[model samples]
Target: MSRLDVTTSVPVFTRPLRSTCRGVPASEAPPLSSAASLVGQQVGHFRLLRELGRGSLGVVLLAEHALIQKRVAIQVLHAHVTQDPARVARFLQAARTLTLIQDAHIVSLYDLGMRDGRPFLIMEYLEGQSLAAFAKGPLAPALVVDLLTQVCDALGAAHAHGIAHGSLNPTSIFLVPDAKGRQHVKLLDFGIAGLLPPSEGAADSPVAADLFAVGVLGALLVTGRLPSRGHAAEEPLHGHAWEVPPLPSDLRSALSRVLLKAMARRPVDRYASAAGLRDALHASVALDGGAAPPESLGLERLPGWYALRGPPGVAPASR
Candidate 1:
């Protein structure tokens, strides 16, 4: 995940400590009026709720729009990082880059602005559990395959826009709840890294960032946990963990190979693009086996093949 250029830590949020609205006398008319007196309360017109998570540069929060009453998730930059203009620009870039993508699976970016001198990226307040929650219990192998394919669709769409979802781990994939509460994967968070560069040039072609992350997420789906920070996930890869989430049985071997290739000691050894690994997954090809993106399954448009993606065990619409 760190190799993806995504910061290797949790999300951190900060607000101005000097604002008069903060550190004010407490009176309980509503959490809002009383909370406004606290540091990092209402950012702009959005009412801050609570912290979601934190990382190297800033924290993410669950907030609501004052007038619209719409729910939103916000990523706020830390005052410390704001001191360095480069980080500030990068913070803004995350939003600008997101505006270029229009995919349903990827978290949708709504607005971009500064609050208390710190910048923020406002996004849809998705309601669901993280893939982290999914992995906590058993994940059917078939469901894993379905989810990965959908992610391929998500990544495929982003790459088409010249964006790389730098971090593609379980923490970044949320299971958006349907009316029935069934699990539907909605990829989230494009904050810490960009898979592609802002311009259409060689400077942004480092796709190993996404390929590596997909491999990591796939590895976790099958293994149900992440490798320790700074630790290479060798034991389970070589064979040790008792629980293994089911994916295509042969998928394990292919995942191992693609992971090694994507995480090559040298980036050059990785697949040229994430689409390449996804192609192999579709064929259910084993390690050492090769496959191409099916001509019918063109990346030019969202794959219509999902209709063939019936329930877990059924055959796709066409061969």
Candidate 2:
């Protein structure tokens, strides 16, 4: 393994590394830690400023373009993980997948390149936190519909391109403010979960799995927690024996039905596509008066919505 020379402020990569195994080239071997050590180093044209966060697959860094000076988020694959050819291929495939899908609700991929034999992705830098932060408690029904509709649109666009997000957890669902200070949804880590080795008895297909996750997200938004997993005494309308959490008393029956269908144990019973799920959500909300318009749901009026934007005088970065 090649170690990064950290004697100075910026770490520099050392050359002439040993081969991982017989016949494997030195360049193909995994390098040293690529996260904190590379803070002041240059990856492609971007200069890493600080570490944003770390995940199972890679480290996300806050970086700035050398020439243009534009701020961006860079996801650098852990050098150790590159030992597996399959994982490396999947990581590159994820970058290609992001480049193929373009939607306002999906995080934009600015560039992709190799740094010291490791793959890195340059993406739009978001100033807001993930949906998980704000979803600690039940959100307003109107707000939920508004936010999720954007998510559905993003997923629908990906599905059209023959790509499934496969991963739709709250952490991957980010919430940023638009120019007008309205909450906006930006789905992150598209096609990432598929990059991992498949688990036993996973969903039959990626599309089905994505829809199931959407249902789980819906339940979380409505109840501020995941639905309990257990056999219900009575079978659900979809003929599945699973427990469904009771919605708030104020919620209308139409929305309740929508939740049930989206969360059906059998994929055949769930919404056929993300668009279908989105339409059902809109229709359900419409039946009970109408959902509030986007402009009306400004983040300024909502508590904790501006938490990620920093203190009062700070303006959010442009997307």
Q: In terms of TM-score, which candidate is strongest?
A: 2
- Predicted structure 1, TM vs. truth: 0.60
lDDT value, residue 172 of candidate 1: 59
Q: Compared with the true structure, what per-residue lDDT tens digits does model 2 show for residues 1-319?
A: 0011111121111111122111223343234265767788766556779977665667777777678786666667777767777767776776666666657777545655665667766565646645555454666667777877888888888788777776566556666666766677767666566455553345446776677667656665677553222222111112222234567666667877787787777778888888888888899887977866777653433432221221121011111
C-alpha lDDT of residue 192 in model 2: 60
Give one digit per residue, the lDDT tens place, for model 1 in 1-319: 1111122122211122122122212231123222224235666666777666555555666676678676556665556767767756765775666566666666555565664556666555544444554344333344455567677667776777666665455555655434433455566655545322232212324355566556556656555454423223212121122123334444446555554454444546666665676675664533435432322221122222111121111000110
- Cα displacement (angstroms), candidate 1, residue 30, comes to 18
Q: After superposition, how far is residue 248 of candidate 1 from its true place, in Å?
A: 11
lDDT of each: 0.48, 0.59
RMSD of 1: 11.7
Scored against the true structure, residue 52 in model 1 reaches a CA lDDT of 61
